[model samples]
Target: MHINALKSLVMDAVDELKGQDVVTLDVSRLTSVTDLMLVVSGTSSRHVAALADNVVEKAKQQGIKPLGVEGRTGSEWVLVDLGDLVVHLMQVETRQTYDLERLWSDFPSDIHEVRHGEQA
Candidate 1:
């Protein structure tokens, strides 16, 4: 699937799991690592893991498998590498500590304050 469509699917999956602070960063100009970075926050470790799992499953349904997934065991921060779209599912604390948004501040971002029960 196209990168933008993949991104939307991933975000929808996370939204289904009640993910918050959903942010998408366009990293096309910054580096060749990936085209987009999706960062989302979960309430707890289990929540984060669930969010990540949902995203992975949804992506797989669309015939897209992540290149790799990291930090699932701990669930403090889970990273799903989707070649051109890397997804980050993290607990609020870890997210704050890492401050990935700030680290990649140069990239244009679309921040969505996800509200529960709302359609993504």
Candidate 2:
């Protein structure tokens, strides 16, 4: 699927689920496998799992299947790979621990703090 279309679908799913600190980073220049990385924090483990599942279901509904899913065991952090778009659904603790956002800080990441606004 087109990057923008996939982005829209993922954003909608996360927003509908009330995912917090939703952010999208363009990692095309730094990563070889994927072009975009979307990160969001769920209120709890169950919420994290549901958020990931929602994204998967919505993508499948739109004829887009995930390449793979990870971290469903404890549901602390779930990573969904959709070829060009990789999504990270994490609990607040997990998100802070990994800090993927800070890891890719050199890039001009368009942090979607307001659902539709630029980085803060």
Candidate 3:
């Protein structure tokens, strides 16, 4: 699938899981590590885990397998690596503390603000 399509799929999955603060960063120019960076927030540890699981399952259904997953056991900050894409699911507090947005401020990204009642 195309990179943007894959990105939309991932975002859809995150939306299905009711993830908050979902943002998609176009890191193609900033780094060679990945084409895109998806950042999402979960209400708590369990919520984060659940969101990650949902994303994994959704990706599988779409025929995209994650290369690996990290931080699942603790669920503080789960990172799903999909080679071309990297997804980060974390608790609000953890996300705030890590401040990934600030960390990767140089990268050009499209910020999609998810309103509470809007469709994901």
* lDDT, candidate 3, 3-110, per-residue tens: 878877888888887899887666666778987788899998999999899889988998888999999999989999988889999999999999887778744554
Task: Pull out the clashing pairs in model 2.
Answer: none
* Span of 10 residues, lowest total lDDT, candidate 1: 109-118
Worst 10 residues of 3 by lDDT: 110-119
lDDT of 3 at 76: 89
Off by over 4 Å in 3: 106-120
Query: How far in Å is the alpha carbon of 71 misplaced in model 2?
Result: 0.7
**Which tens-of-lDDT digit does each residue in 9-40 have in candidate 1?**
98789878889988777767777898888889
How far residue 23's Cα lies from its native spot in candidate 2, in Å, is 0.9
TM-score of 1: 0.86
State each model's CA lDDT, in order. Answer: 0.84, 0.87, 0.83
RMSD of each: 3.8, 3.0, 3.6
Give the lDDT of residue 43 in candidate 1: 97
Q: Estimate each model's TM-score.
A: 0.86, 0.89, 0.85
Candidate 2 Cα outliers beyond 4 Å, as residue runs: 106-116
TM-score of 2: 0.89
Clashing residue pairs in candidate 1 (N, C-alpha, C atoms within 3 angstroms): none
